[model samples]
Target: MSSPLHTQPLAALRRQLLSRDISPADLLHSVEASIAQHDPAIGAYLQRDFPTALAEAHRADLSLPLGGIPIGIKDIINVKGQPLTCGSKMLAGKFISPYDATVITRLRAAGAIPFGKLNMDEFAMGSSTENSALQITRNPWDLTRVPGGSSGGSAAAVASGTAVATLGTDTGGSIRQPASFCGIVGLKPSYGRVSRYGCTAYASSLDQIGPMTRSVADAALLLQAIAGPDPADSTCRRDPVPDFSAALQGDIRGLRIGLPKEYFGDGIDPAVRAAVDRAITLLEAAGAELRPLSLPHSSSAIAAYYIIATAEASANLARFDGIRYGHRCDQPENLRDLYDRSRAEGFGPEVKRRIILGTYVLSSGYYDAYYRKAQKVRHLIRQDFAQAFAQVDVLLGPTCPTPAFKFGAHTSDPLQMYLADIYTIAANLAGLCGLSLPCGTTPPTAEAPALPIGLQWLAPPLGEATLLRAAAAAEQLLA
Candidate 1:
């Protein structure tokens, strides 16, 4: 029989301490046991810190935010003294982070143990864990299917019970799609709400750190811990951070939700559409008004995201040329040869593919035609959201066109994977807050695997409080 420690929320685990039902060591033992027994095939954990984590858990005292909860960190974020590989062999055998990422610092303050780091797409470029420079992080639901990337391992960690919850970075649906795939909640706060100080950059403009957890409230608690300004990141916003958990209790009565016609167009799976419709019905029942709206420029969000994100990626990744940092080529006649050979050998096919595409788009002659046009399209897309928000307080849409697809399902074709993020990219472009929560499940089929559908609730910038309230309301109905 499973112990109470084996199957309960992190919050409940803390309550046991008050009643002396279980010592912190006993609780940590359960988590450590689960990870040891289950993670071999899953590959969710990139690195585990069991002894130190247990030591911290044992020392924790009094009412705490996370209350001795263990968590999984996406490999891109720096956790002082932990292996901070961004899922790449380029940085293999590397462990020299001098500072904690803002989120890690906050997690420690909240009494949460940073137990491990999880796998991700190399440099966070792919949609599935298949591209992880480390081992592939398999989905907890089907094992054969993908746990979406570049935050795949983080999602898989939470879903597989390796941790009660995990942190992920969303840059083009990385967080929400995996959450939808893994049957959990994922939030992407507005840009700057969460500090990006110690995070490795993929697409600086698009990347924002967020949380993945089993419940809306649990994700909310994680968000509270991580969302705030940090001096190291110049882009970190200084706006007042609201208490997300408290704000979730507010009434969403008369709240307006926009359903974009553009997102429901061709390529959207029928099952995904049905699940989102069901979530919409739930919101309507919870006093949220719904209306069909048009984000005409949204159709171009994919093209824009690719150009902008890849351009930023190309620049950010230039540092990995392997002279002062990372893996250097063994047989090099000179400096240029060493730089060329190191990057060429270290970067995976997908990583090379994007760098080439981005370089081409941002090159001298094509810059105005491709990169500049995409930026203009980005403005139009942002305008669409701004105009729509004038009429509707928030937006509702499918988190992904489908769910936990087969491992190689969208990999053969790059366009297919890019299209999967069509519905979620505009929020990032507009710098708005959004979240994905379990809505309904699609029945299994030979062609389509069984997976949870997520309803994406998006609000204007700095609107996380309202976003969670709406998500919780929809979640309550879906439940």
Candidate 2:
């Protein structure tokens, strides 16, 4: 029999805690037990808070909505008194966050306990966790492969059951890709749907806070807690977040689901195509209509994305000089050396590469050619989505054209690796919401497991409630 803590659904989980059938302390212990067994092999957490988390868990109010569920916060986001290094060597020993980020404050108010800070790619710039300056977060199913990135560690934490849910930023494919690899549910809400006040910026326009969890319902529960406007972040949406958990009844009958033609072509793996086909059949069985759609400029998404995203990253990361804090190299002769070495010694290779590319693209003469052209292409991409959604309620595609690849598969060539995020970059560039959910796991009868496959579901800005209601139906039928 499964433990009461393990068997309970979100509602039952909360109920058991409220009735004292399972105390928050016992749940925290289970979390630690899970970590002690899984993390060494998985690299899920950047830092674990045992005594502190247990103490907080002890005081957890069962009446709270999240019910004292343990949460893993990606390290780039602030957690009071915990390290927010953003997973780089420069921030090796940095300590203490004096105040909570807006999202952090909200999570606490919802009665969730933060168990630890998870890892990520340096400065949230890469698609694979392999680029992490500190550690590589590997796939839970197959250690040889990556748990997609830059929110990799967060995905792995939830996949391995180290924490019930986690918070991550989706600047590009950061959250969804990793969630896809880990076989869980991840949502990158419409840009500005959640406040970015305490979250570190990757690309201001592209960055959004979101949840990565074991189920769509759990992700919905978290969105309810975190999705409201905050005075500290002017970018936040003023629209009220409807009761998402209540909205997930899973009736997708007659809903139009688009199958983007460009997303189903040559570069995709056979296994991935097969998995998405099965998912579509299941959605069809659920009474949804699946039709072919097109996003022609989709081919240019990576080229345009790198140009815009890196330009923003280069500017956002300039503040980490020696004088300001975070990380500082000792003994500088002048301000120039201080800035030069602090950044040189501080940033990882992938970060430096992006910063260099961004600087080159934005430099005086090239801006109009490379950067401006990319913007025009961005408009074309958004228009493509606008045209498609006019006929479809939700668009579907492969989250990644292939399953988790072996570590070091595309590390040597940046362009080759960027293709891994092709299916996802368009959503970020269009400033829309998208999700990735487990459709199937390969080698159905294998003793050890190969890797899992995912299906992508996308909708216009602020359509998560609708998108997830459709996904909830699929999840049940697929199971």
Top lDDT prediction, candidate number: 2
Runs of candidate 2 with Cα error greater than 4 angstroms are 1-8, 444-448
Model 2 steric clash pairs: none
TM-score, one value per model: 0.96, 0.97
lDDT of 2 by residue, 1-479 (tens): 45435424567678788888888888878878888878999998888779998888888877889867888898888888887788887675764677788988999999988778898998887877887888878888888888889999999988887777889889888989999888989999988789999787878988988999888898899989999889999989898888888779759899999999999999888878998999899889878998997899999999999999988888888878877666677898888998899889988999999998888899999999998999999999999999998999899988999888888988999888888999999999998999898998766334346678888999898898888888788889889
TM-score of model 2 vs. true structure: 0.97
Local lDDT at 411 for model 1: 81
Q: In lDDT terms, how accurate is model 1?
A: 0.85
lDDT to native, each model: 0.85, 0.86
The TM-score, computed over Cα atoms with residue i paired to residue i, of candidate 1 is: 0.96
The candidate scoring highest on TM-score is: 2
